[model samples]
Target: MSADSKESSVRLIITGRVQGVWYRAWFMEKAINLALSGWIRNLNDGSVEAVVSGLRENVEEMKKTSWSGPPLAKVDNIDVGIYKEKIVNSGFRQLPTK
Candidate 1:
């Protein structure tokens, strides 16, 4: 399969009022709905981090939707980068804070 046709993964570091607003849960729900596989967690720096893996289109959509997180979250910025590693989990999950 062509590279573009395969699943893609990205590591997103979302900042600005992301924590404490149920961002992780919201993200998990979105991932599940998108039929994605990966994990979401909260960092100690008040930012939310997630590794999303899925079809290229789905991954792109997730990246866009991340900017407008949960209703209570005031998302300032999202740092997105290609995640080279594979996602072992078969389904999306919400992990403990780091």
Candidate 2:
């Protein structure tokens, strides 16, 4: 949230053995560590969905690490999209399944 730095946000739909493998928890931890803001949740479709917003460089780092996820997760694919808005007053959290 600074004038000099560009904000970057992304919607990540992670698939393949992501749910039930601590992905959301891991995501929360990683996002916080990166000083990013957003939320992560489980989708009924068996994929994990997350929205991350922060510094452009931080967002890029998140994308690089999130592809691998936690050790137990078998990440087959990640559907990445440009997220336009930041979640209001929200920090990184693990949301209930949607």
Candidate 3:
């Protein structure tokens, strides 16, 4: 599928002070606002990882938003990868830290 086409999933790895800053909650809010389906969680490496699925524009917006997280969050870098899958259909969620 083209970049502009509606995507089903977008995996992201956000680094920096993303953990312990309500980043997961903030991300869930953003995803819900965009009517996206996905989940956010803190990784064992102190980074935040997420997989969002929705319209192309919404997923793109989510990726952009990850660069500038919640006001208390200091996002250093955001890595994004898009994928075409059928594993997402639920609403946004803030997963437990791993």
Candidate 4:
């Protein structure tokens, strides 16, 4: 699909109290529930990064959910950007820190 379409991809870099709070697991659960295809991982900069691709509505929902992360997370900011790469996977996963 084209990048301009609604069914696209987004990379989210979420900061603040995100680490050590099961944020990646939470994100994985939500993304899988939404039937999204992508992966989430912890970054070296104490942030959580995720690449989510699916229906625009589901992806948007995931973005909104990222703000409230797992109750223990205090999300300060989420830098959302378009991700041009396509996801070859079929389910959500938690990748190793990068």
Candidate 5:
């Protein structure tokens, strides 16, 4: 889809052994490579939380990839919420661990 036609953002909470397994770094790489913009961080509850904003297809791709996570991550579940949001120029980033 054209960049201008894309309009969606997804907040994802991934559970399991996601923290301390390079999940953030791996997600950053994937997002950047897909030309997606968003932020990812570790939660105090041992889950990895992320917000991906971009084209609908790209955001969906990100969610799909997140389900597997890094090889070291044992993803047990992924909870997602979709919302309408304006697209921004921000690049992918790994936020401070919580």
Candidate 6:
């Protein structure tokens, strides 16, 4: 498929008081609700990282919402990365801390 019309995918690294919180779990639920597929995990630097794939709007919405996170989270920043890969629907998951 052409890159322009391919599915959208985003790699987000969320910083701040995100660990020890329910961020990963909550993000998984939200991603699923948006019918997205990808993986989420805690970074060794006390940040949260996720690679979600779905429609452009859904992915963008989720990315915006990630900055706020769950009620207990104190998100400071969310870094988005650009990658070259097709988004395959593989279902969302929470992975071990990296």
Predicted structure with the largest TM-score when compared to the true one: 4
What TM-score does candidate 6 get on C-alpha atoms? 0.91
Candidate 4 residue-wise lDDT, 14-36, digit = tens: 99999998888888988999999
What C-alpha lDDT do the candidate models reach, one value each? 0.89, 0.88, 0.83, 0.90, 0.84, 0.87
In model 6, the clashing pairs are none
lDDT per residue for candidate 2 within 1-98, as digits (tens), equals 54565887789999999988898999899999999999999999999999999889999999989888888998999889987664664678888899
Taking the tens digit of each residue's C-alpha lDDT, what string does model 5 give over 1-98?
A: 34466557888999999888988899999999888888899998999888888777988888888888788888999999964465475898888877
Q: If candidate 2 were superposed on the true structure by all CA atoms, what would the RMSD be?
A: 2.4
> On residues 43-65, what C-alpha lDDT tens digit does candidate 1 reach at each position?
98989889999888999999999
* Candidate 2 minimal-lDDT segment of 10 residues: 82-91
Tens-place lDDT digits, model 6, residues 1-98: 34785468889999999999899999999999999999999989899889998888898899888887889999999899864576568899989988
Worst 10 residues of 5 by lDDT: 1-10
Query: What's the C-alpha lDDT at position 26 in model 1?
Result: 87
TM-score of each: 0.92, 0.89, 0.86, 0.93, 0.87, 0.91
lDDT-wise, the better of 3 and 4 is: 4
- Please say which candidate is ahead in lDDT: 1 or 3: 1
Instruction: Compute the lDDT of residue 79 as modeled in candidate 4.
Output: 98
Model 4 is weakest, by summed lDDT over 10 consecutive residues, at 1-10
Candidates 5 and 6: which is better by TM-score?
A: 6
- Local error of candidate 5 at 3, Å? 15
Alpha-carbon lDDT of model 3: 0.83
What is every candidate's alpha-carbon RMSD to the true fold? 1.5, 2.4, 2.0, 1.2, 3.0, 1.5
What candidate 3 gets wrong by more than 4 Å, as runs, is 1-5
Question: In candidate 5, which residue ranges exceed 4 Å CA deviation?
Answer: 1-5, 84-87
lDDT of 2: 0.88
TM-score of model 5 vs. true structure: 0.87
Q: Choose 1 or 6, whichever is better by TM-score.
A: 1
